[model samples]
Target: MGQGRGAVMAELMFWEAVRRAHDEELSNDPMVLVMGEDVGVVGGTYKATLGLYDKYGEDRVIDTPISENGFTGLGIGASFIGARPIIEIMSVNFAWLAMDQIFNTAAKVRYMSGGQLEAPVVIRSPGGTAHQLGSQHSARMEKVFMGIAGLRVVTPSNPRQAYGLLKSAVRCNDPVFINEHELMYNMKGEVPEEDYFHPLEGSEIVRPGRDVTLFGYNISVHWCLQAAELLSRHHGIEAEVIDLYALSPLDRSGIRDSVTRTHRAVIVEEAEPMVGVGAEVMAIINEECFYELDAAPVRVSALNVPIPYNHSLEKTALPDANDVVEAVRSMFGV
Candidate 1:
C-alpha cells in the first residue's frame, strides 16, 4: 500500500506531461513544430508548452496571430509539405472558427488523396468547464467529431494517462484531437520517469469491484472514484470504475468486461444526457452486455439547459458524486 501510494504521487501533472511530450517530439523530429496564440511567450493559455520557446527557439515554438482558421490551415498546409504541426486552439469552443480547415482539410485529406498524404497534425485544446465559465466555454464537442470518420479523439482523465496518450497522439500518422479538461491542468499523478505510450483505443479500469460499473472520462472520472469510495464505505457496495480515455475509439472490451463482471452500469458525464458520450456508452452496453446485465444501464449527466452563471444552479446542473452514488443505488434497487 505504501509503495502504491508513493507511485501514484510520483506522477506528473497533466500539463507537465504535455509539455514533456512536445519537447521530446520536437527534439526527435525536426519536422514537428508548435504554433498557437501565446504558446511561445505565455506558454499557452494553460501553460502546457512552458519553456518550449527557450529550448526550441522562436521558429519552432511559434506564437501565431489570433486566427484559428488561418493557423489551422497553415498547420495543415505544413503537414502536406512534410512538417508535423501541433496546433493549439486556446479552447475547444474556439475550434468552431477553424471547422472548415479541420473537417474539410485535415480530416478528409488522407482519405481524399487515397492515403498518399497523411495530415500528421494534432489539435490540442483546453475544453470543458472551469467552475462557472458558462455555456460558451463549457461545451463537450467530442461527439461532433465522432461523426467524422478520419479523426482520432483522446481525452485522458489523469496525469499519467494524459502523458502516455498525448505522446501516442503526437506520433500517430492521423490527425488527433487531444482535449484537455480545463480543470485538470493542475492535477498531479504518477507518470513513469521513462517515456511511455498508451494505446489509442485502450481503456483502463481505475478501480475494481463487482457490484456496479461506473464509467466516465476526464473530470467526471474523478467524481466516479469519489462516488465509488462513498458506496464502499457507506453503502457497502464495491463499484468498478472504468475510464474511457479515448472517446472516438470506444473501448468496447473494457466496457463489456466491467459490465459482465458487475452486471450493472452507471455512466456519468459532465455533458448533457441528450446526444452526449454517455448515450453512446449506454447504447453500446445495451448491445454488447445486455444479456449479462442484471439491471438496466443508467446515465447520470449534466442538465440539458444552458449552464447557469449562478454558482448554486451550476452545481445543481452538473453531475456530482451524489448523482453517481444515487444512480448506482437506484440501478441495484438498493
Candidate 2:
C-alpha cells in the first residue's frame, strides 16, 4: 500500500496529484464524497477527478448541475451531518455565486452554534489568468477568500504540495478553500508515495539566500523562483524565495523571520496590487519586521485593471519573472 512506510516517490502532474489525494481520501473515509460539475462520468473540468467516478462509483463521486450556490450549499449542509464533501467549483469566477453559503453558513456555523456544529467542507477551484481565458474566467480571488476569519485558504505551488495539502485539508475539521492555478494543471513534480500531510499554515523557503527575500504563492511562486535564478546567475545576488501557500492566517512569524534575515523583501503576485496577496504580505512585513528592514519592501503585481482577452494585452497586464527581477533590482540599485 502507498500508506506503508518507505513507499517510493513518483512524478505526477498537478491534476494527477490532486486526483491521487481525492482517491486516497475517499478510500480512507467512507463518508467522503466528491460533488461538482462533470465530476461524475465526465470527470472534472481540469481532469482532477478523472477515473474517480468509475473507481468510487457515482454515489461517492457525484456530478452536480451548473449551480454553484446550490451544490456548494448542499456540500456544506452535508458536512454538518458528519459527511466530508469535496466541492469543486469548475471555475473560481462562479464561486461568487456561492459566497452566501461559504461565508455565512460554512464559516459561521461552528461559532453560531456554540461549537455544536462544524463545516469540514473542502472547496477547490482552478483560477488565474491562463492563456487569455478572459477576465471573467481568469479570476485570482485568493485575497477574497483569505479575508474570511473561519476558513482555511491554501494554494499549492507544485505537485508535491498539491498532493499533501489536499490530503491535509480533507482531514482538517475547518472549511478549506484550495485555490489552484489553471496554468499549472500540467506542471509535473515529484510526490512522495507514502501518506503524509502538509501543515495547514506556514510559508516554505524554496531557496535560501542572504541578499533579499522574494515572497509569492501558487503561480507567483514560480515567478519568484525564476527571478531568483536569474538574479543569482547574472547579478551575483542570492535571493531567498518563500512560498506563502497558506493565505488565510498568513504566517506572520515566518514572514518576519525571513525579512529579519534577508533585511530586504519583495513580494510577487499575479493579482492586482490593491487589496491583494502582495498587499497583505507587505502589511505583515511592515507590522512585524519593520525594524529589520535594510530597505523599503516592494511588491510586483499585475495591473489594477481587469485581465484582458487580447493575448498581448493579457500578457502585458500580468506581472512576470522579469517584473519580479526588476522590482528587486530597483531596491538594490542593480
Candidate 3:
C-alpha cells in the first residue's frame, strides 16, 4: 500500500496527508506519540488526528487539558527523555501560551546541552485566517517563529508538499514548527505513497515561465498558481511560480535561478507587507539577483492592517489572484 507509482496520483486532502504522516511515523517508531486538547476523543479540531486514538490507544494518543503552556512543556520534557512527541497546538492563536516552551526550551535545549541531548519534537498548529475566525484566531504568526533562532519553520502549500514536508519534519532530530493553514485543510491534491521526501531547505517551481517569477508559500502559492494561469490565458504573459515550502531557510538558490531566467519578480504572501515574509524575499532578491533584475521586485501581500470580520473587507485586505496578476503586470510595465 505504501509503494507503486499508481499510488502517487491518488488525490488526498491536507488533513488526510497529516493523518497518513502521523499514522506511518507512529507505526514505525515506539517513541512517537500525539498530545493536544480534544485530540483523542474529539479527533482534533480539524480532524487531522481522527481515528488515531482508536488505533494507537490512550497512552499514545492523549487528550490534554486546555493548557497550551503546560502540555507543551510536558512535550519538551518527554522529548528530553527520548520520546518524540507531536505537540499539536489547537491554533496558532493559542500558541502564545506556550511561547516560553517553544522558544526558550524546545528551540534551545539541544544547543544548550552541547550535543548531549536531542529534542526531536514536532509542534503542529493551524494558522492564518479562515471563515471569519476573529482577530486573535485569524492572525498569521509565521513571522513570530521566523525571528526565533535554532528552530525550523515550514509552511507547505499543497497536499504533496504538506505530506512530504511533514514526514521529513517528524524524522528530523531538531525542533520543527509545521504551520498548516486553517483554510487549506480540505484542499485536495495528489501525494505519492512511495515515501518521497522533499528537502526542507529548498523551493519547488510549480510553473515555469520567462516573463516574471512569482514567489509564494503556504496558501499564497496556490493563489500564485491560479494567477499564473490567468496571466497566461488572459494577458499572454508567462509567469514562473515558485512554492517556498520552508520559510526560515529561504531558498536563495531557487529564487536566484528563477529570477535570473525571468528577469522580473513578484513576491506574494498572505501576511501583511510591512514586516512580512515577502519583505525578506524582496531583500534576498535585491542582494543576490540585483544585477539580473529587469524591474523592481514587487510585493503583493495583505495590507498592513488587522484582518477584518466583514467578508468583503477581509477579501480586500488579503492578496487575491487578481492582486498577483496586477503585481506581475506592474513589475513588467504591462
Candidate 4:
C-alpha cells in the first residue's frame, strides 16, 4: 500500500513478486531452501525462482532431476527433519507423479504421527489452461489438493498476495500448497516495499457492492473484478467481488457475511463445476444464509471436458468476465 524499495509503491510482475518472496525467505531463514526441477541453473520454468540460484548458491537453491516423485519425497523428508523446503513442480501436470508423497506423506505426516511430526513444506505449481497448453498440461489441481485432509491451500490473485502469502507459507508449520495460475506470470500489480505478510487464511472484499457477490481467486479473481466493473457501469448492478485466496482453510465468515448482505452470488472458477470451490461456497451460502438469499448461487466454471489444445476451443472451455456478468444479470432478471 505504501512505498516499495524506496519508490512510491513498487509495481511488479507476478513472477517478480514470486521471485521476491523466494529471495526474501531464502535470505532470512538459514533452513529455508528451494528444491525442484530446473530451479537451479535454468532459474525455474516460469522464472519464479530466478536469481536465487546465484544468490543462495547450489545447496539452498537446489536443482532436482526429472523424477518428480523422488524429489518431492526428498523435500518432504527435509521438512520433517526441520528444514523448510519449497518444492516447485514445473507444472501441476507433472505434480501427479508426486501425488503419493504430497497426499500420503506431506499432507498426512503430522496427523499420522499424532503431532510428533510437522511437515512444514510448501509445494508450488502453476496450473490451469494457458494458451495452447493441452489437456494433460493444463489441469487446475486446486480441487484435488484442497480436498486433502491436513494441507493448507492458497491462491493469490495479485503480486502483493503472491509476495505476502509465500512469506506466510514459509513461516507456517503446516504443509501448504500454493496454486499459481500459469497465465498470470506477467500480470503486473503493486507491492509495498515494506516487510508485509498476508494471512494464510481469509478472503478480502476487493469491491463493495449491494446487488450480488462475485467470488474467485488467482486469475479468476481478475475476471470477477472485470465483470463487477461492467455490471456497475453498464447495468447499474453493483457486484461485490471477493478474493477467496485461502481455498483449504476457507474464509467461511467472509463468504457468509457477503452472501448475507448481497443475497445473490456468482462463483467464477477455471476448474470444472463438480466438487469445486464454487460448489463448496454455494453449500456454505445455502447452509449459513439460506433465508437471506434471493436467488440460487450460480457457478461460472470451465466445461467438464478436458482442456483442448486449440486456442479457440480452450477459450470456450474456460469461464470469462462476460459469463460472470451474464450470470449476475440473470439473478436480477436485468
Top TM-score model: 2
Ranking by TM-score: 2, 4, 3, 1
Query: After superposition, which runs of candidate 2 have C-alpha atoms over 4 Å from their true positions?
Result: 1-7
Instruction: State the lDDT of candidate 1 residue by residue for 1-334, as single tens digits.
Output: 1112234345578889888888888998998999999999889888889999999989999999999999999998998878989999999889989989999999999999999988989998888877888888777777777658899888889877777777787788899988789999989877766667777786878999999999988888999999999999998999999988888878888889889999989998888888878889988998888999888889999898888888898888888999999888887677
User: Model 2: per-residue lDDT, tens digit, 223-299?
Assistant: 99999999999899999999999999899999999999999999998888889888888898889989999999999
**Overall local distance difference test of candidate 4:** 0.91
Clash count per candidate: 3, 0, 0, 1
Point to the candidate with the largest lDDT.
2
Candidate 3, residues 95-207, lDDT tens digits: the string is 99999999999888878989787778889999998977767878888878877888899998988777778778878888889888999999998888677565678888889
Q: In model 3, how many backbone clashes occur?
A: 0
List candidate 4 segments past 4 Å from native: 1-8
Candidate 4: pairs in clash: 4-193
In candidate 3 the C-alpha lDDT for residue 203 amounts to 87
Give the lDDT of residue 308 in candidate 4. Answer: 96
Candidate 1's C-alpha runs over 4 A off are: 1-10
The superposed Cα distance between candidate 4 and the true structure at residue 68, in angstroms, equals 1.1
Better of 3 and 4 by TM-score: 4
Rate residue 196 of model 4 by lDDT: 70
TM-score of each: 0.95, 0.97, 0.95, 0.97
**RMSD to the hidden true structure, all candidates:** 2.9, 1.8, 2.0, 2.0
RMSD of 1: 2.9
lDDT for 67 (candidate 4): 96
What tens-digit string does per-residue lDDT give for candidate 4 at 6-28?
54468899999999999989988
